[model samples]
Target: MASAVLYGPLFLQLPADLVLYLCREHLRPASAAALSLTCKSLFVLVFAGTRPGFNGGTQRRDLQLLLEKDLGHAPLPRRRVLLGSGFSIGYRSVRLAMNRHFLGAPNGLPLRYFDVQGISLGPLRWFEKWSARILQGELFLSARRTMCGSAWTDEALRAALDHEGPRYDICGHVSMSGPWSISNVTALHSAAVSASTSARAPVVLVPCRDLVEACGRCLTDYTTTVERRVRPVQGGGVDGRQTMEYWFITITSFHRLGSGRSPWDAKWQAFGGRPSISTIRLRRDMETHPPGAVKAAWDEGEQAAVSGHRRSHSSPTWRAC
Candidate 1:
C-alpha cells in the first residue's frame, strides 16, 4: 500500500525511455570513470541521507564510511592477496583532509583551518609534518583539477583526489591502486631502484616530451607522463651481465572552484565567497578537464571528449552561467 501510494502514477509516468537514454548516454564512459562515479555517488549518498526528517549527521558518517572503508583510501592488491582483504595499503582520508585544509585555507586561522606542523595544532601532528597530505595535496594537476579549493572533509577531499593524481596498477594488473601524484610515484620508484639489491624492472614516471605550456591563463594546466620501462636483452653484455634497453611508455588520463552567493552576482562562482551550491558545481566543473597528463604520455587512441565548462577566473571571460 505504501509503495503504491508513494511511487504512484507520477513515478510510473516518469518516462522510462528518457531515463534509459540518459543512463545509456552517461554510463557508457570508459575513462576516468572515477570522476563520473564521484559526482553520481556523492549525489546519491548525500541526497539519500539528507532527506527531510532523516538523521542529520548520517550523510557525513556515510561519506566518511565511503572514504575509510569502501575505497580503501589507497587500495593495493598485494595487501588483499597476501595480507587478506581490508588490509591497509594506506588510510588517507584524514591526511587528505588535512592537506586540503592547508591548501584551501586562503582566509583560515592558523590552527583552526590548518596546522600540519602543529605550530598551532599539536606537537605530534607537527612532528609528522603531515607527509600524507603533502603527497596527495598538490600534485596531479591538469586543466580539470586546480591547485587549491576550500573544501576538506572526507568526501570532498576524496572527490578532489579522484580528479588529481594518476591511476596506477599493481601485481601485473591483478590489482589496482592510485589517484596518486606523479611526483610521489616517481620519487618512490627512484628510491626502490636505488635501494634494490637485485636487478628488478621498475616502472618509472618521467616526461616523455617537453611540457606543453598551455597554462590556459593559470586555470587549465597541462602535463605529460612517460613510464621508464627496462627490458633485458637475451644476449649478454660485455661483463656477462644482462644488457637492458630502456623504453618510455605512456599512460592515458581522462578526468575547480568557486563561489556564487547571489544567482546574479558576477563573482558568484569564484572561490572563498558567500557559499552557494553552484560553487560546488563550478568546482566540480573545473575538475573535469581530463585531469591527467597531456601530449607524449597520452598521445595514442585519440582524445576523450572534454565535458562541461568552467567560468574563467579572469575578468575578460568569466560570466554568469
Candidate 2:
C-alpha cells in the first residue's frame, strides 16, 4: 500500500514507448533491485529486458531476474596455505566485483534488501526470506600434518574434515614419532621437570575461538603437524635408575587452508592452483593458550640427545592462517 501511495497511479500510467527514454541506463545490480520495489509497474520496467519471455508478471519472474547478476565477493585476498604445504603454483582465480551481496552485508544488513532512498524498509514479515539468502553455503576449513611436504589440495582436506563428523564437532589426534622411550604425545605444561609422570597428560587443544565462535562461520575442520624434532624437555635428577630422560612436545601451532577467501581478494586454491605471489613465507605466529588441567610432566635421567639426534628447542615455523 505504501508503494502504491509512493508511486501512485499517475506514474504507472506512463506510455510503454516513453519508458525506455525515462528509465536510467546501466543501473547497478543493487540499485536496480531497489528501483524495482517502487511498485509492480517499476519492477517490470527495470527487469523487462533481462529474460527472453519475462512477461513482467508474477513475483516469481521478478526473483529469477534479480539472481542473474553476481553479488558479494572479496576485493583483495591473502593467499591461503594448507599448513605444511606451499602455495599452488598455477591456478585460475577471479574476484567478484563487490563484497556485500551474499554472506553478511555492510551495516549487517540482510541479503536482497530492496528499499527506496528515503522510503521505509518494507514489512517485517519478509525477514525470513532475506535471512535464507545470506550465506553462500558453507566454507570448509581443515588442518593436517604431513610426513615431509604436504601439498594436499583443498578438496581432499575438505572431504577429510567432513568425514570426521558433522560440522563443528571435529576432534583429531596427532601422534609423535621419536625414540621408544618417549613416543607418546604429551600436552605442554608449565610444571617443572620434577613433576611426576605417573599419569599421562592429556594434550588438550585450547581453541582459539570457543565452540560457539569457531562454529559460527561454518569454518571448522581438523589437520595436524608432526613436531618430530620439537621435544620440550628439561633435565631432572636420575629417577628409578633411569639412564636417560625422554619427553613429548606439545602441539603449539595450528593452521588451515582451502575453500575460502582471504582478507584480500585471493581465493583459497587447491594444490597446483593459483598463487598471489610467487615468493612465499610461513612466519610463525606464536599463539599461546591457557594451561590445560593435565599437569606438566617429563621423563628423567636422559642424555641431551635422544637416539643420537639432538632435540630442537625451536617451535615449528609453520604459518598461522
Candidate 3:
C-alpha cells in the first residue's frame, strides 16, 4: 500500500525516464538492475548518463588537505628517487584525491597517494592496459606517467617490453640506472647492434659531454662498465683520452644507425635529417657518422693526415717549390 502511493505520484508527475533514473541511482544496488528492467527509460539514464558531478572540483585534492582540514598541518611531499646530480624522480601525493574523484566518492579523505622510490609493476601494467583499452581516453597519460620510474630491474623491464598488448618502451629509462655504463663496451656494443637489428629499436638518449674525459670516469666506474668495454674496441690503439673520445663518437654513430638512417651518409647530411640541436658540432665532418660511414671516412682522413704529417716532417730539408 505504501509502495503504491510512492510509485503512483512518480507515474503522474515525472517522466518515465526520470522516474526510472531516480530509482536506479537511489535504489539498493541489487534492486537497481531490476528497476531498470521494469522500464528502458531508467536503464539508459542510469547506465549511459554522464558521470554525476561531485560538488566542486576540489573533491579530489589528495590527502594533504584531509589532514589539514580534519587533522592538522602535515609534512610536504618528499623526494623519493634521487638520481645524482641535478636529476631526481619523485611521486605525486595528490593522486589519492584524483582517484577518489574518479570514483565519485566524497572528497577530502586522507588516502595513500604517493609511493616514493617504489616501482610498482602491477599499477604500471594496469595503466598501460587501460590506456590502450580506452584509446585516447582520459587517464591515459596519468597511467603512463605513474608507470615511469628511474630504478628498474632488467628482468622486470624485459617483461614490460615483452608485453605486446601495449608498449611504453621502458628501455630508455632502464639504460639510465646506475648500471649499464659504457665500461662493458662489448656488451654495450652488442646491445646497440641488436637494437639496430630489431624492427623497432629503442632510442638511447645520452647526455652530451666531452668524449675522452667522460669515458675516464665511465671506464673506472662499475656502473659505467659497459662504456669502458665498448670504447676500447671501437677506439683502437689511441691514448686513454683519445680512446674515450673515439668511443663516445662510436656510440653516437651506433645510435644514429638504429634510428633508421643510412650508415653510409655523410655526417652533415645525416645531421640535417636527424633531430639534433644547434649547439652540437661534429669535430670532423663525419665523426658521428654511422659505423659504415665512420669507418670509410676514418680511412680517408687517416691517409690524408698521415701523409700531410710525413710531408711536413720531411719538408724541413727541402727547398721551397
Candidate 4:
C-alpha cells in the first residue's frame, strides 16, 4: 500500500458542492474563518460566496426564503453549540461570542455548549435566561494559559467585561493546558448535567481575574521566555504523546502560586454569595464520543432536540439564576 498522503481522497475527490454544504452545515464560525485562509479556492468558496443567493435590502428575508426552499419550512431554530478540541486556543472567543449573542439578542439565542476536556464552561445558563456577571482579574492569568503569545489589550478585555450583567449566565474555564492539573478528557467523563445544587439550573464557572493576578507567576515564567522548543515525547509514534513544554512550565509555576491561598478566596463577592471563583476547577466529563454525541446531561426535552427524535417548537434548555 502506498503510504503517501493522498489529496485525492482527502480533498480533490470530494465533490466541491458537497464540501461547501458540509462547511456551511457543520463547521463552527471560527472554523469557517480558518478554512477561509487556507488557499484561494477555499477562500472564494467559503468566504466570498458565503452570502450568495441573497441580494439587496431584504437580507434577513432573503435568507429565510433561501433556507426555506433548501432546508424546508420547519427549519430547526438556529441554536449555537460551541464545539472544539479542549479549548486550548480560539474556543474562548468563540464561546464568548456565543454568550454575547445569547445575551445581546434574547429573541434568537443559540444553545451554547463548550466541548473541551477537563474545562467546564460553567453552568448552562442559556436554559436559565440569566444575565452574566464579570469578575475582575489580572490580564495574564485571567485568560487561558494558552493565550501567552496573544496580544489582547487591557482595553479590549475591559470592554468585554463591561457589558456583562446578571441576566446572562457567564461561565469561563481554564483551557486544557493551564497550570491547573486536571485532565480535561477525564473530567468530561464524570461531569453530570443531571442537576446542580439548584434544580433545572445550568452550571457556569466564572474565572476571577483577581486570582489570575495573584497567579501571574504561572504566566510570566512560561510565556516570557524567548526560547521555544518542540513538545516533549515520552514514547513511540502511534501511542507517542507530545506535551508542550512551555505549558508544563506554566502549570508548575501556577501550582506554586496556589500553595497559600484556598480556592475559595477568589470569587465574585458582589453578588451576595456565589461560588468562589478559584473553587471552580477545570474538571468536567468531556470524553471523546463519536462525531455528534452529547456531553452535558440532557433532559427529555433537550435530548429530543439533540437526537433529532422530535420536531416541535420549544424554548432553549437554559434559564438564568
Tens digits of lDDT, candidate 3, 205-240: 232332221111100111122221223235554353
Q: Relative to the true structure, how large is the alpha-carbon lDDT of every model?
A: 0.29, 0.28, 0.30, 0.29
RMSD of each: 21.2, 22.2, 24.5, 25.1
- The count of residue-pair clashes in candidate 1 stands at 8
Name the top TM-score candidate. 2
Instruction: Give candidate 1's TM-score.
Output: 0.19
Best by lDDT: 3
Question: Could you give candidate 4's per-residue lDDT for residues 3-46 as a string of tens digits?
Answer: 22545235534688887787779965545545655667766866
Q: Show where candidate 3 strays beyond 4 Å.
A: 1-97, 100-137, 140-321
- Kindly list the per-residue Cα lDDT of model 1 for residues 1-321, writing each as its tens digit: 677677653434347555434444664222122222455543343234543222355444443433332222332222111011111121132233333345453221122212222111211111111111112222111111111112233334333323433332211111112333222222123453345434564333223543332222112223334334445556875567675434332222121111111223222222222335753343322243333332222332122212212233334757798
Q: Is candidate 3 or candidate 4 better by lDDT?
A: 3
**If the candidates were sorted by their TM-score against the true structure, best first, what order would they fall in?**
2, 3, 4, 1
For candidate 4, report its TM-score. Answer: 0.19
Model 2 TM-score, all chains together? 0.22
**What TM-score quantifies how close candidate 3 is to the native fold?**
0.20
Root mean square deviation (Cα) for candidate 1: 21.2
- Measured with C-alpha atoms, the lDDT of residue 75 in candidate 4 is 25
Q: What's the lDDT for residue 60 in model 2?
A: 42
Off by over 4 Å in 1: 1-207, 211-220, 227-243, 246-256, 259-321
